[model samples]
Target: MGVVKDWRDKELSISEVIRKYPHISPFVIIKTDVQRRGVNYTEKALAKVDPDIHQVEYRGMFREKGDATPVSLILRDGTSILTAFSVEEGKREPILVDVIDDRIVLVDQGEILEEVEYWEKPDYYDKFTSSGKPMWQIAAARPQRIDINPNQYCQFWETPGHGCKYCSIAATYNSSKENKPKILNVDDIAETVEEALKEPGRYESIFLTGGSILNGKELLDEEVDLYIEILKRIGKNFGGKRFPSQLIGTAFNEEQLRRIYDTTGLTSYTADIEVLDKDLFEWVCPGKSARIGYDEWKRRLYKAVEIFGVGNVTTGLVVGVEMATPKGFQSEDESLEKCLAEAEELAKHGVSTVGCVWNVAPGSVFFNQMSPSLEYYIRFADGLDQIRRKYNLNVDMDNYRRCGNHPDTDLSRI
Candidate 1:
């Protein structure tokens, strides 16, 4: 076990950690910290942003929004840094984007980091859905992926106090519910995806995820049906062939998994376990814990492997949140050991794990809680990558090119 560093051990600055891990890509380390610390642009940096060619706002899954920070960032190396406008409690000084020497760089304190570019706006973003809603409202653009969030309000939030503690979905929904639909209109989704497909090579995958819908004769059945209908509509552009797509939703039973797999054109499956430690999962994701226990969730993931096939299934972890204050693991060493071990267990079952930098968002219950140190996150990402290599598991299903939110998978490019 790595007992060398305590969870509360002095945190390292971005430069210090980068110098420490020479084997890991510095771009990845910078990306992780940018996400961990959150980011905003100076007037000069924002001046370079042309809304006609750059994506200024992103919706659905929670990317920080405020006073037009240009949605998120893409490094010169193509790693996506999904910036949050504000971070929890000002735990770490927010990373800055400033124009220096006629180039945009991510700034930390007085030091300049890397030159980065804003994610480009897709050709379809400026158009409107057939329903008269802006197309960007129906589908958000990632660098090479098309993201469609069918529903924004998680059913888990419907039960007070059950939503994931680090999630802002419930809060994001309540505040915007009056303006947005709880569930998207299927026709709008199909029309937007169809229009997006017209851009040819602009998108590598079509991704769908939304708040979990827990009602049905069998749990997650309605959620399965929802995905089936939407995927079928989008699949029309593919001419009866299975499409490159993924669905991140509730961990459903084998029956539900087969229902979607047998029906839709989705090619991969992901059910975020959130935290690897069972207790941490129970504490951090109370709704998932209550509805689908830890062991049951893993069992469902394994069952997905049987259905989706090996290497096509993966789970995500909110990296540092396993050590969230109070109920979370108290020591970084212990947190790393337990999380890596549990991740290895999942890897053994053909379920590769990916880590999302724990950005303590404004609306989450843990918004005031601090995230883990940079060194801890760097080590965690390397560890998950090593585990996947050891088990011969491939994360291409959600790798850097397909989905850039995960730091661990970004290492796979090396």
Candidate 2:
């Protein structure tokens, strides 16, 4: 195990640790720490934001980086850290991104760690639709992809105890004006995609994801149909050709998967298993287990690869959640072993795996729970990366540039 750097107390700097793990990008390590602890802006940092050019007060459910604040920061290398705006009680001392001496840099106790740059606003961000809806609201642009959320509220949250333990989707949804509109208008989505595509060479892929839609002819028929409609609409922009896209939704059956593929230009599919271990998944994601069952969920993922094709479909796992207390794996070593084994099983069937570090948010059931150590995460990322390589599966859909949230996928670049 590597020595834990006392970066918060300034006892040991992250820069020192970066030298130790030369295999992992220095930017990634910093991004992980910033995300794990969260960030706080100094007055100087906030002052650097430009409302007109940057995305500030656009109508959305979540807060913008800042009016003049850059949407997100990029390190010396092109690693993106798209953090949410959150200020909660007892939070750790977040790294401060400040404009010190006319240069935007990450500072801790006035120690300049690295020069950083804000994520540039996309070309279409300033454009508006003929109907006057700001294109940014219609679709949120990432470095290499466009994000579309069809529904904001997960019905599981409707009941007192059915929601997942580590989710703030409903809380975040309630706060957004765009999501407050409830369901996404299919016409609006089609129109927005049409306009967004006008900026040539801007976007490499389009992705659609949303909260669980439990209503339909079958369990997720309604959810499946909603995507089918939107996909068909967006397909117009691709001239009926399948574009690079992924749908991170609830696990759908073979029938539902086929229907979606036959109807739209979607090329990749993802159904986040969330937690790798079965018992932890049951307790942490009660709604998912009760509705789809753990075995069925994995089955659907493998089945999706059959429909979407291997290298084109994958399942996401919340990397640290397997260690959640009470029913979770007792040891970090055990958790990593189990998660990698399961991932390999899925990979053998042509279903790739991606992992995102669990962010223990205030609204989650595991809010008070602590995540695993950084060393544990690094090992887990390394292990999962090996599994993908062993299976020879492709993860271009959620790789570093496309998604940027998955540490395991991030390691794929190595």
Candidate 3:
């Protein structure tokens, strides 16, 4: 059984939560809830998808069973609902996707909520790199961003109990026999980006992230070198010194960060802390805690602000992991209070916090663990957005357009 409780008896319904937080965007709330409780496509709904136009192939960190499924859904207001298509261990049922009036609409309990569109495949998605690798396999596309995961597997999972309990990167990579290239060829990535940029206003920015690369002369030196090489190649396309880009890599020392900043057109940086509470972090992400420690991770983020500038440096939190049973906080109130307090502290140091709703995956250690209530997610996102506003920080790199995975950053558009 999942750790999530029957919140219907304890908390407000989705409509009630929206009613209470009237200031929050109803579309964002619906997106958040849809992400929290994933979606299932009916036969008619799946038929609406055009594999050539709509994104139907799996790329990046996660892998699905078949060759195709809608990559993700897009709300009418340009809000991207980036979620996996999976049932959460029978803990909760996903909302239904059905065709209504020749449009795809999300259905809950037989009621149509809103119309949604599948993410469209970019022009480069069907092309092949000079190296004979499919360009789509090398890079993935969002509504306004081109995502490149050069390093697919994290080294932290090598140890018995090191990987983050809530993460499924290692499992996904291990099971993916077809997607074999672990680290992307720099030339292929550059070629893919060049082709993607030719699609006449299809992409706005480039985003890169992957599992932690722990091997280096000094902890993450090798990892830093890899990004510098990739960024330099990607930078060749742009004539300017810096292009609109973001790298969500592991926390590196000042020297390592400066190396990438000085060498490439990389614009923004992020190092996900995963969880705010130190104790819970150690329990949930033992590898991260053991390799870099919680305090040092924050220090790296602060140092990144010095080099990358304020608003350009951010940290992501797997919100609600602090409520994991046994090791996590016991109550939602306690978890929310503690998390926001820590987020506030980071914001004071010119670091913004972004929230990614925790959807316990089957491959994760916390697969059976339940996430927090929908109310908790709304309050958490609100708190993080308020913190960024208080600090006068901008999350343009990870905002609604660039990377729409975070609910907190999604608030930046409004």
Best TM-score among the predictions, by candidate number: 3
lDDT per residue (tens digit) for residues 1-414 in model 3: 643456467767678888999999888888888888888888788777777788875534454334357878899999999865354453556778899889899987788878999988788877999889989889999878999999998999999999899899888889976868779898899899999999998788888888888897899887888888888888888874799999999999999999899889999999999899899889999999999999999999999999999989999988878998888998888888889999999999999999898887778898888777889999999999998989999999988888888888888778
Reference-based lDDT, each prediction: 0.85, 0.78, 0.86
Q: What is the TM-score of each candidate against the true structure?
A: 0.94, 0.91, 0.95
Worst 10 residues of 2 by lDDT: 1-10
- Name the candidate, 2 or 3, with the larger lDDT value: 3
lDDT of 1 at 345: 91
Ranking by lDDT: 3, 1, 2
Residue-level lDDT of model 1, residues 302-368, one tens digit each, is 9999999999999988888988889888898998999999999999899989888888877889878
Task: Choose the strongest candidate by lDDT.
Answer: 3
Clash count, predicted structure 2: 6
Report clash pairs, candidate 2: 49-68, 49-69, 50-68, 61-176, 165-365, 216-222
The order of the candidates by TM-score, greatest first, is 3, 1, 2
**lDDT pick, better of 1 and 2:** 1
Question: In candidate 3, how many Å is residue 32 off?
Answer: 0.8
lDDT of 2 by residue, 299-411 (tens): 99888988999999888877777887878899888888888888888889998888777767776777777666666676777787888888888899997677777767777
User: Model 2 residue 383 lDDT?
Assistant: 81
